[model samples]
Target: MLKIEEIQEIIKLIDKSSINEFIYETNGTSVTVKKSADEYTIQQPAAVTAPPVIQQIEKPAEPVVQEQAPQIAAAEPATSTKKTVDYDYEIVSPMVGTLYHASSPDSDPFVQIGTKVSSNTTVCIVEAMKLFNEIEAEVDGEIVEILAEDGELVEFGQPLFRVKK
Candidate 1:
């Protein structure tokens, strides 16, 4: 069983990190921490000697579309003026992590706009839990856009770059 202070510390760490969910188990006790939007929920068994009881917390839905109506309307003209070319492929992040354009701080980015890449060419690195994962282009194409910025926290399946075959 986790003490209150220990559980608080874990919550603090998770809140600061990019992790969406964390689970810890010891003996027969289990603790789960989950983050949804800006809220955090901690779920744990009430006691070790009793049957585990699970409780769920839910939030009421907000009118997100209504709130963004003005912003979408405002950007319509700008989007209409720009030429829309359908991209052939999108290089996406495989996991939730911080995106790094270069292996090191002083190194050049692996790929940039107009840079041609092979299927196996590394385009960027996504650092998750201290592991630096080299992201591949996966398709032969010229990079048309770098969507995510360096050192940005990116979610799983988030587009990192757009490519034209």
Candidate 2:
């Protein structure tokens, strides 16, 4: 088993290096470190009884390809005199993590469609590395649309809700 200091050292080394993933196993102990975007995940398993098996299979030769004829473009439609443009404000995620609509499983969501919110109102929670981060609406408006579903994995700067001021 690796000590806490050793694990921390391994994590630091992995973060500094260019490699994205590192797996080490010895004496029935296994440690796996993986990097996703700008974050690093470290997982230490209790034990490993056997080494992983990797098998390579040969691929068959590529078949002959045939080119298809190009299609003609369609006629353009007539332009309208008036155009309506949307000016909705998007609430984006601050970090890459799993999005939660509510604080707990049985609790109600912080905000929903048509819910009025201020600049500091909590709208959702983003869980990253076991830390729950409350996400707030940065503009004073009403939620017009929910872009992401509950318990979905969201990327940094991804829009979670659309609000109309």
Best by lDDT: 1
Tens-digit per-residue lDDT, 1-165, candidate 1: 667667767667665555656777666677777755545566666435535544333434433332111111111223246556568999999999999999999999999899999999999999999999999999999999888999998999999999999
Tens digits of lDDT, candidate 2, 47-73:
678775322222233332542321212
RMSD of each predicted structure: 13.9, 15.3
- TM-scores of the candidates are 0.51, 0.51
Q: What clash pairs does model 1 have?
A: none
Predicted structure 1: lDDT: 0.76
Off by over 4 Å in 2: 1-87
Q: Give me the displacement of residue 18 in model 2, in angstroms.
A: 34
Tell me the lDDT of model 2 at 125.
99
In order, candidate lDDTs are 0.76, 0.75
The global Cα lDDT (0 to 1) of model 2 is 0.75
Ten contiguous residues minimizing lDDT sum, candidate 1: 67-76
